[model samples]
Target: MIDAANTYEALFVPALFQQWAPMVADAAKIESGDRVLDIACGTGVLAREAARRTGRSDRVAALDPNAGMLAVARSLAPGIDWQDGAAEALPFPDRSFDVVVCQFGLMFFSDRDKAVREMLRVMVPGGRCAVAVWDAIENAPAFAALVGLLDHVAGRPAGDALRAPFALGERQVLATLFKGAGANSINLTTCKGAARFSNMREFVEAELRGWLPVMGVVLPEPQIDRILAEAETILARYVTADGLAFDISAHLATCRRP
Candidate 1:
């Protein structure tokens, strides 16, 4: 799990979806006084944004099993209650929060069913639970183009290291997980955003600094070199009037525990 997390912290956390604070805040639908729990709140992206949206940090609890990631979250949002734990084994008592959220973290849990049940256990009856994951890379054109190029240039080994949360995009599987967790009413929404860079250099830096960990896991060094070369080619496709564009497709899933 730590291996998975190292890759996430490296490849995605900083440059990929960090700017989705507004999206997270908007989706949170937090009341000023609502007690919220952010399970597996990696680096506090959603937790800090949710705190801002809720108008106070005190009402939000950020939980994660990774201390390094939690440390980063704590630095940005000191007032938030940061706890070291996993989604399957929460420290809080039953029905403790008015809202529960997990973003981009559901796909990695060792036991998805147990984790969802734990999330349900901590939520106040009728409270909301929200989870977000990336759409399949195949459906995300900008990313897919880069992936293709990498496979062409970097070879297969480098491309394989970049894989993370591979199962997240399957809607049928996701629906079953929610149903099994006892969330009978589920709402699914899709969000589209873009990651913009001024040039290939900028894009490479963003990915290297932000996504290298995941990339390392999926693609071997030779493949990474090839992938980076392909990334340059893909960047050419998105050269707009101003800069390069990398569009993102994300899934927003919300459910109610009745």
Candidate 2:
């Protein structure tokens, strides 16, 4: 496992989080004066959103195991209270937050159950804990196509395998995870967004410099370049009257502790 200290910002910051904000905010239900905690708050995307809703009276605490990501978070969203901590072992005391949110971070945890339990432990009674994860490859055709084309062209291990944990989009698993963590009610919902690129080049550029770094473990430089060329070809099909439109889908799970 790569140290959390090293791999967050470049791997997950702008790329993964650009699609997560809306999903998390909708599921977490940020309200005025609500004290919230954003676990794995990569660059403080969710934290900033929550803080905006909470205003000055209340606070939004953003926590992450990655010091690099936390540095970016502090710079990007200074109003948020940024802290260094892991999801499985949160630093806060029990019942510290009215809402605890983890966006795209739950899947990376080594101990998913313990992380869920820790999230609940920090939430006040009746408070909410919400998590967002990516759907399976088939459900996200754009990403699926990208991965397929990349692996085919590069003749390398698929990058999507590294992202397997986030594919747990089933409602049953979401419910069970929360219930086992002492939550009384669980709600699951899906959010879909469109990412428009002028052409395949821009799309490839975004992926290459963005979350593509995360796949470096599986995709080397030569392989990534080959994949990019193939990705451009496949994405050309999606370019129509407007532009290249790729669908981004996420599963949002919200649970309320008894």
Model 2, 96-121: lDDT tens digits are 99999888778778898999999888
Using Cα atoms with residue i matched to residue i, what is each candidate's TM-score against the true structure? 0.83, 0.84
TM-score of 2: 0.84
> Cα deviation of 219 in candidate 1 (Å)?
7.9
RMSD each, Å: 3.5, 3.6
Clash count, candidate 1: 16
lDDT of each: 0.73, 0.72
Clashes of each: 16, 0
Candidate with best lDDT? 1
Runs in model 1 deviating more than 4 A are: 1-15, 149-161, 214-227
The list of candidate 2 runs beyond 4 A from truth reads 1-20, 153-158, 215-221
